[model samples]
Target: MTTHSPHPVRPGHGLTVADAMDPCDYQIADDSTVDQADNILRSAHIDYLVVRDHNGRCEGLVTRTGLHPFLTGSWYTERTAVSTTTHQRGPFAWPSMGLSLAAIAMRVKRLAVWPVVDDDGYLLGVLTASRAAGVLDAVTTP
Candidate 1:
């Protein structure tokens, strides 16, 4: 039997990408020099940074490995790290996914981190496995 509840499901309300993501200021502009980007990454103490363009659009990702080649290259000091990102990103965490079993899916994947993007592919934020677990716990706890 279908029982009526006071709060019905909304289209897109809770646990959205915006809610689950660990908001960070670790985005590096695409035009920034490799040195500049490296500094940011170092200061943030993170292995990955969301790569954004002039319009603040998600271009790709910049990881420690992605920057490895440049570290040994002669032009490393002069080149931009944007082009070194992993173009074919593994998975993107969309805000809409949080509506369903997306968080569970990510947890199952065991990804260290992933990017959260909007419909327009803008840089929303980053998501970590621990953060996803926290969301799952919160949703299941009560």
Candidate 2:
């Protein structure tokens, strides 16, 4: 079944990235195996996993696509680390960012899920492309 944002976003309105982001509940250790990350992505029906370091800090992101080779290639039996497949460690949004700008960045970068972080670089949540487009369709739609 498909889901959508309940409310539509209007540019120039008071809406913010916080309004469109979902909580950061799902995560995987950087040292985790590619197979492990794949299992979580499949089970959770999510495209990405927030990779965390030993100290529990947000490290980077690992996508199902990143693990595809390991899952299907000769390395399927190998315990490839999730960190090796992770990306997007530096680009993240803040709660106060305008939805318009966030949407633009996601579009330009072709990001399926953009991480949202707090002032101290702690993860707050993620801005999914589907959710952002659903609500901010007006802004993105010509």
Candidate 3:
């Protein structure tokens, strides 16, 4: 009698998504409007804001690209502060995700920035696609 042995599964290796993602990332409150997010983006020199809840958990993300349209036409007024319109939904990735996966998501989604979350879905940090690409280029070129 011949018995077949079970195949052993290989564990995941390499840099997890958290490794590629920034941990001490900036975040904005959900109560903040589009206008506020825009000003913060410009001053902070960032394209995306991780929207946080009252408890400081990440809820969503707002991008300057999404806020730009609302500034045009009558939608915006002179008295309107950078806190009027609501921000767009946020995109997030898990820490266990691979760098390659993150890179693919950034390219296919055309995302300028992506937020990294913990196992509990708590906000971790922001990952700029440009920065990631630059780092990758440096590593691969050398």
RMSD (CA, Å), each prediction: 4.7, 8.7, 5.6
lDDT of 2 by residue, 1-142 (tens): 9999898855646668998999877899989888888889999998788988887778878887777877788645757888777367866888899877898898998887888888877788999888877877765568
Best model per lDDT: 2
lDDT of 2 at 89: 80
Over 4 Å off in model 2, which ranges? 1-10, 75-77, 137-142
Cα shift from native, residue 116, model 3 (Å): 0.1
The weakest ten consecutive residues by lDDT in model 1 span 81-90
Q: Which pairs of residues collide in model 2? A: none
Off by over 4 Å in 1: 1-16, 73-77, 87-91, 104-110
Estimated TM-score for each candidate: 0.69, 0.79, 0.68
TM-score of 1: 0.69
lDDT of each: 0.69, 0.81, 0.68
Ranking by lDDT: 2, 1, 3
lDDT of 3 by residue, 3-70 (tens): 77596533333556665677655677766665667777899897677778767777767677667777
